[model samples]
Target chain A: MSEFEIIRDIFAPLTATAPGAFNLVDDAALLEQQNLVVTKDLLVAGVHFLAKDPLDLVARKLIRANLSDLAAKGAKPLGYFLGCVWPKHTDRASIEQFARGLAEDQERYRIGLYGGDTTVHSTKTGPLTLSATFLGTPPKQGMIPRSGASLGDDLYVSGTIGDAGLGLAALRKEFKFTTVDKASLSSRYHLPEPRLTLGTALAGLATAAIDVSDGLIADAGHIARACGLRAEIDAVAIPRSAGAASWVAAQENRWRALATLASFGDDYEILFAAPPAMRRSITVASKASRTEVARIGTLSRGEGVLFLDEAGRPIPVEKPGFNHFT
Target chain B: MSEFEIIRDIFAPLTATAPGAFNLVDDAALLEQQNLVVTKDLLVAGVHFLAKDPLDLVARKLIRANLSDLAAKGAKPLGYFLGCVWPKHTDRASIEQFARGLAEDQERYRIGLYGGDTTVHSTKTGPLTLSATFLGTPPKQGMIPRSGASLGDDLYVSGTIGDAGLGLAALRKEFKFTTVDKASLSSRYHLPEPRLTLGTALAGLATAAIDVSDGLIADAGHIARACGLRAEIDAVAIPRSAGAASWVAAQENRWRALATLASFGDDYEILFAAPPAMRRSITVASKASRTEVARIGTLSRGEGVLFLDEAGRPIPVEKPGFNHFT
Candidate 1:
């Protein structure tokens, strides 16, 4: 079963009568009357990142991953509770390095570590597992939900997609690139920039929003499916970094390459929906937040998603997203 | 380095200016002005519990552990975000069983599941990791802090201590017991009852409180150390279940056996301190909450903890409690 089916059929009932839970459909949950929004994400070494990856970068990546969720809902993060299980016999220096990483991000995000647990795995071979529960205050205009999109809403995304995917590919030595390109891409994978400011700015403007962690097309589909609308996107209109564009240029089938990029996960950018009439306002908000925004699609009265090429020809995507359980 | 040192020297600084974090010393953190309290706990199969345990029981253990933290702070649990990393190849039935456990507890505790991530481990051998971030509301009298214990405060514990520890021993086959005793002990290890009602009732009366997860003596030390005092316990005063008392009676060295039992972890009972003047009030509250209470010790000037015999002689304890990292 897919992750969605598991959540909907097996786990959704656990949510009971809590309306803030959103029936486990939204990226974050609201604490009614407290104006608080909360989100949690767990990462395991070798699954989410290389087991040998530097502890500091791993720490930052974990923090950013959850922050990206809050950003999607226009929540200003207050603090996070961290749950870390280090591998057995991990040295103090390594743990200190991890703390240094948390300190760096804590300063950058202006959030504190509220409280958490740290335990060393009992088995030497056990993986480094980490979980962060982030708490934030929603914008006064209120947090945006992914299911609030309307049929006529125009979809926009912050920053570029595919760079992080390419970066992962480069890290695995799947493809060779220039030193600069490789470094840039690798950095993108290691340190995703959560568009917090942009999300907060768009809270009152965007009808719906979600973070692009499970690929652009998949996340856009989330917004579409939640609102019972079809999302139509121009493949070429999906923003890309210069390196990503160069990589696509070298591929035999440009459409296929672009689709692959759109299907790759880990781009922690905001994918949001707004009315076409709010385009100018979105531009102003994006500029004010110093985040690049691109309009790539529109929601229509239908279901699922449509990926169209420059000539309006549909491109087939075998897999449109990442699902932990398939 | 011990877990406490690692937390104090490295992780504590990350708390920064968040006073609610209590410098990462408290079991739960307060969200200033929100009247909300939050706590997080992580459990890994093979470390926190046997990997072969039933999925439903494991699920309950995870939820109860976090709820135990809330109980220590005298908070009424609102809901929780659950982060689960299921083992690869896990069957749908297993996950369904896990959700069933959660459903059972949500109804029992009047709490709901909020939101969280569910991912399958990339490797088959990876441990089944789970985390729960619980949110709660403090009583009208405000939540009790572990550091609030006074020199003359009486150290009391709700429910019998060491039963869960003895239960673990029975499960491990380190000891032989009657079939009924074994089942009872094993159940205690698998499912701990969090003293929520007692904790809530004691909020206005108890000067300090903490859950007895890391053995009775170690937890008492936590309160004493936090408040810059010493805790002196009358060995005979520590409450024990019928099976535990019988087991202790069979040991060659009564003091050693008692010490061993006190050193075992996972009791899930609330260990707290209240002024001596509130003894009557505490008794009334305990009866009203339907929770048994035992005055095990007293707080005094100085540091550390003293486990004393009937004649007031201090008994030596080689190891006071369980430490995840040492």
Candidate 2:
């Protein structure tokens, strides 16, 4: 059992009666009366980020994570609440930098800093922890829920996957990329671009949607578990950057490399389920947002996520997603 | 400077432009369009609770802290979003206990579990941190802000205060009680009883209000600054528990002991301002809620909080309130 399992077994049941909570399966919750979608995430230093990461980037990443959750729910940013356990040594100057980062993001994302609380943790040696609760609203159609993935729906993902995962590896010096610039890889890991445009465009077009925070198989499995269906993702069909493709080509074990890329977490791209008939709409959406969307799999009457090769043979997954304490 | 000062100097300015945020001075932010009042608080181990504290009490305190914020704003609980960073060794049993505590409070408060996120933080030796964001609405009339204390307003505080402060001291073995039971003091420190009824009643009657967190003097200073006035607190008029009074009476430095008991933090009681004309209304409200209201101070044309003795001379204040990184 992992963090996700603990949530499902112990916490998800608490949300069973709350229709908007989506059983804690979807990225965000919806308030129909308020017409607001809300999601909260806590990021701690050390476990969530490198201990010495810049405070500015730390603040930005915290907000972006919540923004990514909103994007997955097909909602545009409205406002947010922030709660922080400030490291004991944080001075006014450091706090100013953190606030500056949040200000910049609020302006960029058209969200306001609504309210929050700040406390000092005297003994915590790790990076300061921050929790952000983002409130959003769909610009147009109703929210695309994660539980409506009917059988035979085409599974599509936005942008390329595994950049962030590899980026993290690169940060730790565990992996090197000759094809991709180190800065590019690291930026992907540091800052996640929330696909708000594509998600809003998804509206009624995608029956089910989720942001890929966990690895491809793991997050996709969320839709499967929620919709009570199975998802088959083609490893070959997953879009990859030229750098990623080159890195995979350079690997001694190609399939394992591909699995590593696919299973690493923090993609932040929207994975969606829609019927083939709506492929044209998805195409238009991709074109509109100028973000690529690739058809990677299909949904059927089953459970869990299946990773298949070009010839439709099964590919074993070593790490399905970012589940803590697995 | 204190934690509140840091927030005001660093973070409050960021919120000045967002009218919905109320300059981050009020207990909660009003999302008028959403018809929601929101407040968020982060509770960290060591700072907010002991590492070995019961998970049930941890969850309860987290929710109660946010509930206190809502109560201070004269808002009744609607729902909340929770974000928690689980400690590495957190098991299913602890999580279940936490959820049970939350369930009990939700039932007691009539608020729903809207949504939230969970994550595991390994390497955290201290207690896990939790943040709760409460969404509420005014129970009646408009919100009782902190800024409306007129020059001649009478300041009133609901319930006893020093109980919680002394309770914390008792928990840390800094204080011992023979006049009161251990459970009474420990409960005061662990579980804050939010004065929702008193707050709601004061919504229209009280000119200004704030929750007594961060100690009486510190929090009272908030209303003073917000109202651009002065608060003259009569030390003798301050409410205290039998245990706290007994402890203070036994001390050689009686004034300092009294001040320490009065200024210790974690009392979620509501301190409010109303004109002398509203005394009848305050009495009625107190009777209705079955909570005692003590008139301890007065607001006048000045600034800062002043502690006065029975002879109207200043009682030198020390440890005015709780401030982190002071």
Lowest summed lDDT across 10 adjacent residues in model 1 chain B is found at B24-33
> Would you list the clashing residue pairs of candidate 2?
none
RMSD of each: 10.3, 10.3
Q: What DockQ does model 1 achieve? A: 0.20
Cα lDDT of model 2 by residue, B1-326, tens digit:
22234334433443333344434332223332455666777888788887778888888888888788777777878777667777776666676677778767777887766556666776755348888888777645766777777898999998887888778777778767753555688899899998888777777898888888778887788789778999999988988887777877889987777678668888989988999998998999999988899999899888988888788888788768766754
What is candidate 1's lDDT per residue for A18-88, written digit by digit as tens?
A: 34444543222334346567777888897788898999999999999989988998889877777888788
**Local distance difference test scores for all models:** 0.82, 0.76
Per-residue error for A143 in candidate 1, Å, reads: 0.2
Model 2 per-residue lDDT tens digits across residues A1-326: 23234334433443333454444432223343465667777788876777677777888888888888778768888777677777776666676677667766766887765556667776746347889888877656766777778999999999999988878887888877764456787888888888888888888899988888878888888789778899999898888977678778889987788888889888889999999999898999999988899999999888998899878888899878776644
TM-score of each: 0.90, 0.89
